[model samples]
Target: MQSGLALLLIGIQLVYAGKHSLQYFYTATSGLPNFPQFVSVGLVDEQPFTYYDSNIRRETPRQDWMAKSEGEDYWEQQTQTLTGTEQSFKNNINVAKERFNQTGGVHINQVMYGCSWDEETGDVDGFDEHGYDGEDFFSLDLKNLRYISTVPEAHITLVKVNNNKALLEQKKQYRTQECIEWLKKYLQYGKSTLERKVSPEVSLLQKSPSSPVTCHATGFYPKEVTISWQKNKQDHDEDVDLGELVVNEDGTFQKTSTLSVKPDDWKMNVYECVVEHKSRTIRSILTEDKIKTNYAPVPIGIIVGVVAVVLLLVIIAVAGYKVYQKNKGFNPVNASDDGSNSSAHSDPKA
Candidate 1:
């Protein structure tokens, strides 16, 4: 009995130690602590390159024209090499695309062009001029930019989970230390193979709450997300409320929403958290209702205005034909007279 008890104690202690270790890891891997958001430039075949960040915005030393030119040339060479490496990437992407066609996830065909350079500020005005029309590469609010290394090359992407409520529900089963481990693994493995150079670190962390809750959401490619709630088997009659989502450190998004309901509603009905993205939806249902409260209907004035504009257009189109006919000398008496006048005059002469 004593031996069995001892083994159990050892197991418990090991689990405890593991929890703390993750906490320490989570704190350290979060990025260079207090590293003022700043730009870092490296040569990609001698092209002028600039990385924009809060730190760079505050203070980036002015560089001379000759030095900048040399840097740009280096950047250009590196870029050419990277561009050449696209063969393998293209193969991978083609494979991925085939899979996507079968089960659509993300498409690489959307990538028209991408580059990296050395100068503090080099504009391939030409590159910006074409393609990448609706896409935003840099994370303005997070102060994070895509960076690849000189060695194996790098590509990192973050895909938002459609099942946020389920994720949050799973989170509740975790303790503080377990949560730390989860964050670390999520940051480490979730990244693409191309971006292996980046250290396993996350600078900022945000998470969603349980049940009909609200949180920010974002993703790398163009994505649309919807927040909604339902009661019992029927969808909720109340309006679902939402807030703007922001980009996370790993390039995914975080969004929030709120659900307010009476305490009695808990056992009375079920509440669900629904998140829809890219034609897929993930949702979680909980006993408690937490969707946003007291939402107002869409403004009546806007609806009225839209209806009025449609009506006015219809009236104008219908009235235009009458005005056109009048301008064209349309007369019933003239039409009859023109057709029969010649016949009548000829018969009278005969």
Candidate 2:
């Protein structure tokens, strides 16, 4: 569909803020309309950490220039910024009688780079990537750009040459500042629905709401949203149980916050679920009806679920009892055997 293609052209948008990470990918695949044509497709994050296209405000390839053109800047940036020794990879791919040398190419090459960090501490939380060999696994320090890639070639050329140090410094700059601007610009141009906040669908769930009320807020955007329980316009933290933010299928996020209320508070329905988001601040009452939001009867559902579990356990117990009964008789000591032996000895005299 034209609409889907339009979305694809804008590149993939993912919530890097969820885990506070930025991943880079370097790839080459033959078999295109123009075999060696270069294209950028963003996935696993909001936008590519850096931009190199005709429309964006950056050093794009010149109108008459190509990716492999002599004295170019794109692939060199790819090699230096992320992959220090990519030239060797190109040489191997384009070796004699390969796709680069043939009319129809049949080779695919790719490298993935990823790291996680805490925004507040600015310390290295985690880092890893796929190297270019059989033993091509790497763990890295995002803060200082210290890395230990398993590939022997990568160790010799990249880590020894201090390539990751430069790459990390630049990556932080682009990810925090440039990446944000690019996402806004692209989303605005594409008329992306991401701009609209599909207000959080607050549902009161769990077996008990008054005793331990659960307010699940789903289908919210920007991931900067907040959920809490309040009573009489005051922040309520009584027996509160907070949950982590989780991603949803449709690119939005969901989270739950549970609050345990006193018996009287439950009867009076003096509680509300408050959702604070970039778009709006809204609240849903934790009334009796909302408490029944789980739809199925709480007592019935719990009773049925528990019965099923108990029934399963009983079946297992009965099965074990039958097996014990069957095996208990396997080595029986017969009472008649001793008496029969005595009788045979007594008859020997006759």
Backbone clashes under 3 angstroms, per model: 45, 1
Residue range 1-350, candidate 1, lDDT tens digits: 01111121111111111121111000000122443211222111111122212222321212333233334444444233222222223233333333324343322211111122212332111010000111222110111211212211111211111123333222222222233333334224322421222211111111222233332233322223566667775667474566543323232333445555554674577766565655356566653233322222332233344335322211110000011122211111111112111100000000
TM-score of each model, paired residue for residue = 0.27, 0.42
Ten contiguous residues with the weakest lDDT in model 1: 341-350
Q: Give RMSD (Å) of candidate 1 vs. truth.
A: 31.1
Q: What C-alpha lDDT do the candidate models reach, one value each? A: 0.26, 0.40
lDDT (tens digit, per residue) of candidate 2 on 137-228: 33334455555444443443343324434444443443444444433343343333434456777777756443566787777776667888
Error of 1 at 318 (Å): 52
